[model samples]
Every structure is written in C-alpha cells, then in structure tokens.
Target: MKRSVVVRLLAAGATAATAAAIGLTLQVPQAAAAVGGVTGYATQNGGTTGGAGGQTVQASTGTAIHAALCNRASSSTPIIIQVSGTINHGNTAKVSGSSCNTADGVIELKEISNVTILGVGSGAIFDQVGIHIRDSSNIIIQNVTVRNVKKSGSPTSNGGDAIGMESTVRRVWVDHVTLEASGGESEGYDGLFDMKNDVEYVTLSYSILRNSGRGGLIGSSETDTGSGYITFHHNLYTNIDSRTPLLRGGIAHIYNNHYVSLNESGINSRAGARAKVENNYFKNSKDVLGTFYTDAAGYWQASGNILDNVTWSSPGSDTNPAGPSMPSNTTVSIPYSYSLDAASCVPNVVAATAGANKGLQVSNGSCTPVSPTAGPSASPTRTAGPSPSASPTRSPSTSPTASPNPPSGTNLSLASGAGADGSSKADGTSYGNVRDGSLSTYWSPSGATGDISVKWGSNVTVARAVIREPSGTSGSIGSWQLINYDTGAVLKSGSGAGTITFTATSLKKITFRITSSSGAPKVAEFETYAS
Candidate 1:
C-alpha cells in the first residue's frame, strides 16, 4: 500500500484506513465516537499512523474525523467532539474541520441548553471567553478557570461583568469556578464580584474576595426596596483597596466575617438606606465602625457587635462635648417616644441642672433621684453626703464683700434698712441690714448674739434663700428659722445653718402667712450667721 493511498482515503471522507507496505499491514480506526453533531479535531497528531521502513505511509488523519461530525444526519443528537489542539477559524473550511481552533474564539453556545464545558486546569485560557452562555438554561460550566475575558462594550457604560446576567437569568449556579483577572465594564468594577439590577435570590458564600479596586464585593439596588435576597457570610475581606465597599448594601445579612485594614470604613451602609449590623468583629475602625446618615433618612440597629477603636466626640469639649449629637448625617423624626430595653436605651434630659442628668424615675410629674451613667470607669465618683445639722453656704466662693454687686443690667438693689414683713428679726437689737425692696442682700455680724432673718410680705412669698459666710472665717451659724410673732407657733424651727465646711440644700418657695400678723413681711435676700 502506498502512503498516498492512505492520504487519499482521508480526503475522501473515510473514518480510518489501513496500509500494507513491504508485507507489513497497518490498520487505523478512522472514526472517534461522536456523541452528537459535535466532533473532535486537533491541530497536531503524534504520528499514530503505522507501517514499516520504506513501507512507512501516513494513514487516515484528523481531517476525515471533522467531515464526519459536521455532516450529521440526525437532528436529535448534536455531536460532542473534544479538541486536543486548537483549530483556526480561517483555515477550518479548507481543512475539513470544526472551528474549535485559533485564538479568535472557540466554543460558542448559541441558543443551546444542557451543555457542559470541562477544562483540564490551564486549558480554559481563551483569547475571548472560554465559554459564552447566551440565552440558555441548564448550562453547567464546571471545573474551569477562565483567565482574562475580553470586552465587547464600553467600560463606562455597558462593558461586561465577570459573569453577565441579563434581564431574565434564573436559577443559575456559578460554583467552584475561578474568574481570574478577566476585565470588562458595566459591573465588576475592578472587583472579583459585581452585580446589578434585579439580581434576585442570589447567594455568594465561602469565597475569598481580594485585590480588586471596587472592593471585595459590591452591589446596588435600582428600587427603594433594594435588590436580591443577598447573603454575605464566612468570607475574608483582605486588603480591599477601594474608595469604598469592603462589602456594602442595606438588604444584606452581614455576619461572622473579619474586615482588616480598610481605608474609609469596614462596612458602609450608604447615607441613604437602613441596615442591620450584628455580630461582626472589627479590629481598627479608625474613625468609626459604621456611620448612619440623617440626610438620606434611614434607621440603623446595631446589636452584639465587637467594635474596637471606634471614635465619637469627647464629653469634655464644646463642639461635641456631650457625646454624639442627635440628628447627624440622617434625619429622624418621632412622636414623644421612649424605650424599655436596657442595653442601650436612655432618656434625653432637659431643664435639669447644668451638670446633672435628670433622674430616670418620674412620679407625679416630677424628676426624682436623677443619676448619670458612671464617670471615667463605670463607677460613680464619691460625693460628700449632706449634714443635717449644719447651715449651708450659698456662695461657691464664700466671699463676703460689704457690697457685692449683682450681675450687670438688673435691679438686685440691697440698700433699704428694714427686713421684709415676715422675716425673723432680733427681739431688741436694731440690725438695720435688712433691705425691703432688693433682690440680693447680705448681713454681717452686727452683734455677738447672731440672730437674723428675712421678712417677705403677704403680697408675695420669698422664693428661695441662699446664705454665705465671710471669706477666711471658719465660724458656724445657726439655721434660718421662721417665726410668727402673733401666734408664736415657730412654724419651722432652725435646723442650724451651713458652717464654713458645709454646703446647703437647695430650696424652692417657703411660705409663711400668719392670721395674727396684720401685714405680710417683705424680704428679697436671706440672712443668717454664727455667734
């Protein structure tokens, strides 16, 4: 048999051939089993043809294998041919082969279903995509690594996603596959993952997202309700070097993950949407673990999460001196509400003393036993208890100027010599320090007996009385006791005034109206001192 005989049979559409040269016969199985219309073709063959010495003749080749698979008679079965080597598209027709070659493109699945493309590690590298699934279903792309997919559209507009899901793609499962570098536009904005508009009922779990610019993972919602039943868990966000998004969204369940060395935030819920942040560990949350927005209007419920290095305004500075101010980046409006949950629920106080937190227990429309959260280290700093028997000092400085001026632009006159009508004046001595129509009046020790009082007339009752001692004198004083000279009941007896060492109890209006006395006593200031 001549070598030309074998080549002639291959060109004549024979499956396989046999050549006998120098009495040596070689037989070849020309047809490889084709499952459907699909057939196999390779650019190079390793001399599978057989015969002896000058009897050596090239037998039937792969060219005959291509014609058999391309011209299938049955429509029910498509040929499945494996390409051991690449076949160029330009030379495909002249060589009797399928166009599963050349870098231009390979394996185009057009409007077909139930196709599986398996790769042997590095064999899936394509000049274009290794596999393009368009308008198809029941498609499985398993155990393949597609490196560097090319782009068809503009990166700024509709370039491409690592895996593009159009308007109506359902029940698609992309598992255990690596979509390496493979740059395109539209979504995937330099990330390992990206999805947009109507990506409903989708899940990405147990995956590693790293070294992408748009972040580890990114997604957005077209409608206010947001898109997808998104679940992000058990993934490590490492070196996520993007302007934002270590993982971002509102309708997402973010839990059990570690976020390390992020630039802007560990996780950001855009200033517009409400989100639930729970049970996640954050190590260095530089400025904040998370920031909720008020301008865009959303609620944030933070529960059971470990936040280290989160910063808020200081309690000692004026700008944010009393902690974070209400109504920040987001606006919240409520109708006179309160909370019962103790973990982070506390009432906002008003009309209390400057440095005190109004009490939480309110009874009979009054605030009682007001207490603030513990200072410095969750423990209240010790305050000296009140001494029941001592008269108290009103002036924090305890300075006694013969004429202490009231704060400017007010009528706190202290020059009249008679105590107001109901004051407790001395029996025989004319003290002459009482002022009938003044706001703040003080009396010094005119005699050693040391008895004095203020008389506020019947028309108006004395609202409060604050007494102070002369500076540098540590003497003790008797309390300011009220007396009704007509009935002599001594309505309220002296308990003793605050001494040089004690401060007094603050008082509201103390009324004194006697039937026996004709007119009301008039007093503007309180008077008391030691013997």
Candidate 2:
C-alpha cells in the first residue's frame, strides 16, 4: 500500500501459476555481454574484499535489472550491474486481480553467482517490484531504496519480500539500503526482508526496514532448519508493529541496531534458531526481545542491549527474555569481533548512518571494525531480527556520554484503536492509520469537525505525545484540545501540527478534540510515549 512494501508482499493461498517458488527461469536475450562491471558500492561478507571488480553494466528498469543479473558470462565471474532510476512494475511477476499469477517478480537473480547489484548515480528504487534471489550466491547489493514492494497478492513466489532469497542462497551482503512498507496483514503488506530454504552466509548492514508487520524471517517453516551463519548489524528498524525479525534456525549475529515504536512482538526466535544479541538499541516498543508466538523455542546469548521505552506482552510460557531455554549444545560462538555502541547513542547514530541516501555515512559506533583475513571459519549457527548500533571507529569506553535512554513504562493505550474522522479516506485508509506506526499511511478527518481519541484499558501516566502531520497536506488544525476521556480534563490545547507536550498523571483515556480547522486535517501519526 505504501513505499517498498511490495518488496515482500504476498497474499494468502495460491495455484501453480501463483506459487512464487525459487528457481524460476529467466528469459534473457542471447546477445548482451555476460561480463559486468559494477563499482562504487560497499564490500561484502563471505571473504569478498576490495572494491567491486568485474565488467560494469548499466540498467534503468526492472527488466533491465533482471537482464543485468542474468547477463553474467559465467557463474564464477563477478559482474557488477549498476542500476539507476526507478524499477517499477514493468516486466515483473504477472499480476491478476490483486495477486501475481507468475512466478518471477520484478528482478529475479536466479541461478546466477558472483554478482553485484549496485545502485549508482542518483540511486536505484524498486517500486512495487520484488527482487527475488534464488539459487544464487556471492552477491552484493548497495545504495538502493526498495519501497512499496507488494507482497504477492497471491503466493506466486517465495520472494514476496523487498529483497528475498530461497533455496541455497549464500554469501550476500546487502548494505546501505532502504526497505519500506505500509502496514501489516490488514493492509496487505508483508515482510521487508525474507530468506528461506537453505539460505546462509548473508550479511545486512547499515540498512533501514520500516513500517511493516513482519521484518523478515529465516528458514521456511518450523521443520526447515538448514539455514545458518547470517549476520545483521548496524541497521534501523522503525514504525512497525512486530517482527523486528523472526528467526527460525541458524547461527545469527545481531548487533548495533536501532528499533523504535514496535507495537506487537519483536525479535522472534523459534525452531532452534540461535542469535548472539549484542549492543542493540530497543526503544518505544514491546516484546523487543526473546522467543515468542510458537511452541518450539529459539536461543540467544544477549549482552550489552539497551531496553528503553519498551513494553512486553505476556506471550504465554514460550517467551523467554533471558534467552531461549534451549540447551547449550545448539549454541554457536559469534565469529566476528565487534564493539557495542552504548544503547544511549543508537537513536542518533542510526539516524545518521542507516539509509540508502546517506552516502554510506556509517557511524564509528563504539568499535573499529577489523575484518578477518579470511571469511568466517565456523561451521554454522542460526539467528534473525533487527540489528544493533555501535561506533565504527571506537568502543564505548572511548565514546562520549549522552543521557541514557529511559525505560518505557506500561502502555495504557495499547489496545486502543483509531476513532472516527468525518473526512477519512474511504479508498483504503482508516482512522487506525494514526497509530499504525507507518510513514506511508495516515489518518485524515473527513471534515474539519470530528475528534480523534483513544481509550486505554486502564489509567496510564503519559509524559509525552507527538502528533505528526501527514506527508503532503495544506490543511491545519486551527484549534484542538488534548482531553482526558476518563476524567474529562483538558490536559492541553494546540493550534498547529507539532509536538503536543502535556502531563497526564494517570488517565484511562486521552483524545485530541479538534474544535476548529482551516481544512480537513490529516495526521500521519498520533503517538503517546510513557517514561
């Protein structure tokens, strides 16, 4: 529904034409040069060293990206495919109704190895098009913004992710990218990143995954455990409800990432997955850590993590915060040496480093990164979820001190949904947009006349509230009152779309009553945080 969601979008159910399995054949012209020259991108994991070397090729569209991927002279020769401009819905998986009946979607990197897809020039964007990596290895992707990747309306392919892989994918380094979405199942969007079917030896760094239901998943199903040795570091996961990451089985290193405003579950490790969780910043979220939502549990060796402005739900006996109760036999030592950023600096460090347009400005978090002379030598372990944050050049011992992040008190309005707005869009938007933690969607009053409010199950001590304006609108609220619904107290009043700072000591309900407006007002977010 919004930017970059279609990257991993998939609806329920499917047919032969609709199953998006890996290994779909790509039809490429016979004449294009197979050698590719790709450059000006970040180096990769899996022992890839130095700059992107090989033949350089340029592509301007989704078909062109696929062509570039398929144009490799041989599987062993590294080719660089520089993609610039927009890769839209053209030449992607075929769509029928809301579902894609074809197997391949957008750019399909199938049966190709030693490839680098670099976003060059002004940058590369995958809009409503999913990039499927199937049976491929030794790849690198950088400086790309994949937005509105519609999950297949039908389960046409396993690559219903912004950047996804299936069946024997290995050694992929995805860096400095932006993956986005609208909302979750209710909004018809899927995971920002999804990997499955024997996928291994992948690293995602300095990336941003935003506004979606699922962050990503490793291993296909509860019974699928062939995946392992994945590294997630220095990323930003924000404005999503859950699945900061869901790991099934593997040895994963999750460190130095920022997670903000998580609504439901976060860092779901299950089915024998093992994650070494270190030095991550978890803020304004719930269930920010641990195994959840399944009978089979996962494992984590967690340290140097900051849980600030966070809450947790009672997810039955399976959720283990200290780490999964799995035996030590399944654990694997983290392969690379890393430094943890003080949790206090995550929000700022990530803000400065974690996106495609950042020109690869990585924070010297709290440690200097030293690459091993060779690739990781360990046998294999398993893991998944949002990463952490740290200095790239120094350790926390040498970093400057900022105020420590505040821990989140209980969220009294967790169960609250959006209220009625007279001018709300009927096409697809809902009043719930205000609280969905999405930047692509928003709530608009049908008229200048209605009130927007939320009621909590019990009274909450609210210290701050932020009412974010929408993406593009000229209308503004001329007058509004922040009212305490349970006690009928006007906590504060405002006349514009900005931070609504007030102190509600304890209240069961709170509302923004719009008494007057210049036009039908729209709000991208109406959030309340407790400290």
Candidate 3:
C-alpha cells in the first residue's frame, strides 16, 4: 500500500476491528519508517537518533510500555514501543528489571537510553498519566497525547508534568504530541512539558501545549542554571497563563510556533536566560516576551515574528515586557541548519502540521504540508536575515579580526585624563562603568547595540583592546567593532568579547561599537592597551 494511503486511513480513524474485518492486519512500521527527522538543537551532541534499528513492539497499557523497557536485552539496547489505546493509572504498575526502573501510575523512562515510544494504530492517549524521563539520553516520544496530569491532585503522576525530564537528561526529541491540562495549580495541574537538573540538547517540535497555567520551564529554580540548549518550534501554545516555558540560564531557540490567548506573561526569560525567537505568530497574548515576577532579568533576540492584538503591561520592578514593540536585544548563533516557514504562514502551517493524530505530517518550509516520507528538505524558503518588518539594522564593521590574548602593556583606558561616553546607556548603567575596573559595575546599551568610547586629552598609540564581560554573564557581546574615533576608521572587527590586536594607531579617541549581541551586552571593562 502507498504510504499516503496508509496515512490517510490512519488519520481517518481506522480501527483494528475494521481492518481485521477487511482481512487486513495493521502492521507496525519498520525501523526505517519515516516519522520525521530530528530538527533544532536536538541534532547536536552526536544527534538524537532513537531506536532507529531496534525491535518494534506493540503496547496498549502503561504496564506494557514499562514491560517493553524492562524486557530490553540491556539498559542501552535500542527499542521502539508502539503505543495505542488509553493509558491510565489503573492499568499501570511498577515493573522491575535489570535494565529498567519504573513506578506505578506513571510511564517512567528512567535510567534507560536509545528508546522511542510512538503512537500507532487508532492513536495513543495517556489520560492523567504523565511521562517522566530521568538520567537517560537519546530518547524520542512522538504522536501521543497526555492530558490532565496533576502534581497535587488525587492519582497525580510525574510531578504534574505531562512530560518531565531531569537529572542529566540529554538529546530528547518530543514531536507531534499533545500535552495539556484542564486548569492551573488551583485545580492540581502543573507544567505540560518541563526539563531541569542538567538537561541539555532537547527539542519540542510540532506539538500542542494548551489550556494550562504553566506551559513549561527549563530550570527548576533561579539558581538551577545547568540545563540548556533547547529548541521549541512549530508548536501551538493556547490558553496558557504563563511560562510558555520560563527559561533560566540556558540558550533556547523558539521559532515558528503559534501562540494564542496567553492570559499572562509568556516566554518568561529570567535568571540570565537567553532566547532566540523568530518567525512565530502571537495573537491575543499579553506580555508575550520578557522577565516577569523576578528581579533577575533574562534576554531575547527576536525577529520575523508577528504579534497580533498583543498587549503589554507597564514595566515594574519585577515585570519587564518586551512587546509594544519587540526588538532584537541579542543575536544567537545556531549551530544546526533548518528552514523556516514565513511568519505570515506560521499559523496555517502550525495548525496543519502540529499536534497528534495528524498522520505525522510536516511542512516543506513554504507553508505546504507534505507526507512524512518526504522528510524535511534543506531548501530554505527564507534566510536567517531579518524580515522586511524587522527592526532597523545596526551596521557592523566590515573588517574582521582574530581574537588574541590581551597584550602586555599599560591600561590606557584607566588613565587620569581618560573619559568615557556612549551613544546610549541602559537605566542604572553608565558609560564610565566600562572603564571603572570593577566587574561588579557594568555598562549596557539602551537597546541591543550601541557605541561606548574612551577618549584621552592627548593622542596615545594603542596596539590592542580587551573587552571583558561581567561575571556570570559571559557571551553576551556579539559582533563588535574597534574603531579609531578620531579618524572614523575601524581598526578591528569581530564577534564576541575578547582581546584583539591591531596596528598601533595614535588617536585621541577610540570607540568600541557593539553591533549585535546574544543578550544585553554587559561590558564590565573595555581596556585599551599601549604595547
């Protein structure tokens, strides 16, 4: 049978009884079956290939899912468990084996690796049964629906997360699943999808997270800064109160997602978290991006996003909204390659391709839904350059230079006659702070990019400059230019804050121009050297 025909039959709710009556037994897909390829950051760290050449088994109950894991030949053995029917607490029990660790009431994927749990044959639904993963790697969960798992209610599972991962988890790709809740913490529900405790290199793609108080979070606390390198794309977030994943001290790529009716703050980036948000559509949301409910600020680099009827609240000591006019405050460099559907088509594309029971369909990056067999092509319909409606461009320097160690010389920036100035400064920050020689005090641009210069009463021959960032906030400065302000000539240009050597230029003034950044660039010290 053609793959498209099978997909159509499955999408039309074909039943096993009907297939049996028609003298056709439903066969599980083989190891090479194309459910969809891994995208985003999950493609890093040796890549997330889950059970590609492993034995495929059928599972209807949660216990069977546990048994499938326990029955594996070894803890690292690859296996794909095809789940169907409704999985609930009554049918779930603790299963023991040398290879698996499981508990009652939840689908626990613990201390195991190279596993894939996929929905097949009339669909798989985990009703009030959450999926928990811990201390594992290279796992994939796809085409399943988990709803109403609570943290504080009766028969709670997985700490109220529809899916939760922790304790050094890595390389998990969750795709085409529905994770939802009926209400907020008052109703005993918690996050839909969450990760913490050194979790890294994960991706949540083409999924639905809706009708919940909290969508998800990267780190569990403000100080839990170890987890990072996540991607959320082509997902639908609707009727969520907050956290659309509160990020803390990690780098996240959020793109091509559809957000609607966010009751409160969304994408709460805090505790030094940095996000690259692009090509998404937001409608009827409030405070869609910012740091909220915490004094510790987060940062974002936004572009190619369409915000329709979004509202922003007044900035407070603890609330900082990025909307009203969302601008890119940073520039994040993504390692992997992926295509993007236009922001205008994100709503339509996400609605058609996201969520379970959609035949595992995916986009061809031009708003066209294609069969999973076609897979994701590399033909990018859109480039990473800013959109037409994007914020005004900040031109970077033309000449690129290599970063080197700080030159051994006198610090010219701290001279008695030296003075500092900038194009603009953020609140509570002064341009003079960059030469103050204290890492505790720093200077930030009014927005993402600006210039700060150190001027001398007399001309001085400078050979190098060292750009130092504040502690705990490294890697904020992106593209920058070292210019002789007296001559308007760029002496050196590069990305990142470090020492750069240049020909000795005798000038009265020199400027360090930040043209791009991953977050608010905090220049603790911009030291000029005369070697």
Best by lDDT: 3
Which predicted model would earn the best TM-score?
A: 3
Tens digit of lDDT per residue, candidate 3, span 261-307? 99998999999999999899999999999999999999999988999
TM-score of each: 0.32, 0.57, 0.68
Q: What number of backbone clashes does candidate 3 have, counting pairs of residues 3 or more apart or in separate chains? A: 1
lDDT at 231, model 1: 41
Instruction: Looking at model 1, report the run of 10 residues with the lowest lDDT sum.
Output: 39-48
Task: State each model's C-alpha RMSD to the native.
Answer: 39.8, 24.7, 15.9
Off by over 4 Å in 1: 1-160, 164-166, 172-189, 216-226, 242-250, 271-279, 283-531
Query: Candidate 2 local accuracy as lDDT?
Result: 0.60
Evaluated at residue 90, the lDDT of candidate 1 is 26
Residue 214 lDDT (model 2):
81
Per-residue CA lDDT of model 2 for 40-115, tens digit only, reads: 1112122332114555656676544543344343334455666778777644433223211124456766655556
Better of 1 and 2 by TM-score: 2
lDDT tens readout by residue for model 1, 202-288: 333223334333332323432333232334433344444432232234344443344444433344444244344344444443323
| Candidate ranking (lDDT, best to worst) | 3, 2, 1
Cα lDDT for residue 163, candidate 2: 83
